[model samples]
Target: MKEIKTKIIERIKSHFQDAVERDYDYNRLDFSVKKETIPSILFYLKDEMNFKHLSHITCVDWLEEKEFEVVFILWSYTDRLQVYVRTRIDRDHPVLDNIDMIWRQANTYERELKEMYGINFTGLEAPEEFLLEDWEGPPPMRRDFDTREYAARTYYTRPGREDAQDVRETIIKRTGEELPDFAKKYKR
Candidate 1:
């Protein structure tokens, strides 16, 4: 494991000078690189380094920093290794190259990110609406999106069901079970 990790680190550093490698967990490594180098690095890892599996792709909105961190998780079945390719893009203009060509499943993840985070994936060929249906609002997954406020404005109570029910109280009534003192704080 150590030898493979060392070789991967050395190869990535030699090929992509801007890549910064770190070992934060057992059998896992993180490579932070410039957003522009994402496609090339992913291609290299998949084609050359035997990291053939694209496990997941996720995004983190850094509202304070005005950036969005995109992470591509890859797995190597043969080596039993996990690698996270991370990059940050400007929040104001969150545009990134579409890597669906490298992995077909990437199209689904990219489409979700495009709709949820407002991150534009240039050249991505997919439906405009991925998860959300008939939605006309700011990206719901973004950190700055106020879910409570949105719910208040968008949802309304029925006349017969106007009162909100407390789940904990309802459960206690049905089961005759008293919650612990510490858990009582979570009561509605």
Candidate 2:
């Protein structure tokens, strides 16, 4: 198995002559493939290399770098070669050829990345309906997507008491019972 991994890596390395493979934190080998080679690499994996299954496609919105890093993790039941093909793209206009042609599973994952990262899937079917149906805010998975800010804007606070007063006050109002100090701290 390890021999196959080394050989497959060697094979792909020739294609991506300038690419860099590193041991990323999470105990996964990471390959920083070029933006342009992404489509070809995926096709090679699916067709010639026996990686028939595309596990997932996702992106990291590196706001600091002003780039969005894309990840395509591929696997196969036969040879069991798992490799993560990665590339970086401009944040403002993250356009890439859709890999749905290579793997049909990429369709759903690309759509997910489209909504979650705000990264365009080029020519893929992803309407802003359902799931994130009313999401008019920043892409939720992006580094800049602030949950607190989103909550403030999208969520409505009801008139009923929620963190309006302490639990003791609410209990006193509802049950008309006084909670002893020590027990009050422990009880909900």
Candidate 3:
């Protein structure tokens, strides 16, 4: 397994000199590359290497860094290995090339990322809405989107629950036990 990993790492590094090898284990490897090299690297891995399965595509919102990390995970049944191709894009102008032509399932992941993370996948032909329909608020998955604030502003309180005591207070009262100081701050 170690030999296979070393060979794969060498192959990738030799082909893409800028590719940075990141954390890995016995079964997984990660490579960080510039956003522009994503299409070529994925093509090389899928065609040259035996990584034929597109496991999934995910995004991470680095709020403090003002960037978004887009990760493309792939799997190889023959080698029993997984590779994560990671790239970071500017949060203010998140744009990426659509790779649906390489793997058709990429459409679904791209659509979800487009709707949820505001990522514009150039040439991705999909419906405007994937999961969220008629959503007027900011991308809900983003770290800047406040769930509590959105709920309070968008939803109305139930007619009977307005005066309801905090659940913790009720539990403490019924059990005749005092809540710890840390739990008291949650009282509304």
Candidate 4:
């Protein structure tokens, strides 16, 4: 454990000059860096180090701080190791430079974030509609998109057992068992 920690710290320091903080939890290491340093850090990890696989790119909407943070999870196939790169951006005009230069496949994830989270990835080939076709209002993934209100307004929910016939009441009456809650309530 001690050796792994020492090696991971040494590796990050040796490989990435701009890594601001090293955080570890859930059996994975996280590297936080300035958004501007992303291109350099990604280049170093992809080309120099063995972080050849980009598992996924995700975002955390920190509404309280009014910033959206992006995370890129990278994997080393050879060492079976993983690392995360995280950066924060202002929420008012949440925009980020595309990581397509480092990982061309990052475009797909970026597009999803653009559609779902409304975080504009400047210069990416974003189409008009992707996840939600013709979304009329605020992006659903943002902290402000009130899901309950949205569902009440736009979503159609199928009536469930609450909307069922009084089958339970009928069964209770036929069997002469203690009246079911539904039957008791209906009697009142």
Best-fitting candidate, scored by TM-score: 3
As a TM-score, model 4 comes out at 0.76
lDDT of candidate 2 over 112-158, digit per residue (tens) = 88788877777787655535877777778888778866876778866
Model 1 lDDT per residue over 1-188, tens place: 99989988999999999999999788999999999999999999999999999999999999999999999999999889999999999999999999999999999999999989999999989865779999899999998899877986899845654234566676787899888898777765
lDDT, candidate 2, at 178 = 73
The residue pairs found clashing in candidate 4 are none
Superposed by TM-score, candidate 3 places the C-alpha of residue 87 at a distance from the truth, in angstroms, of 0.2
TM-score of candidate 2 to 2 decimals? 0.75
Q: For candidate 4, which ten residues in a row score worst on lDDT?
A: 161-170
- Of the pair 1 and 3, which is ahead by TM-score? 3
Predicted candidate 4 versus true structure: per-residue lDDT over 126-178, tens digit per residue: 66687788778888899889986798688776677343456765576689778
Supply candidate 3's per-residue lDDT for 118. 92
Predictions: Cα RMSD each: 3.9, 7.4, 3.4, 7.4
Per-candidate local distance difference test: 0.92, 0.77, 0.92, 0.80
Worst 10 residues of 1 by lDDT: 157-166
Task: Give the residue spans of candidate 2 off by over 4 A.
Answer: 23-28, 127-130, 157-188
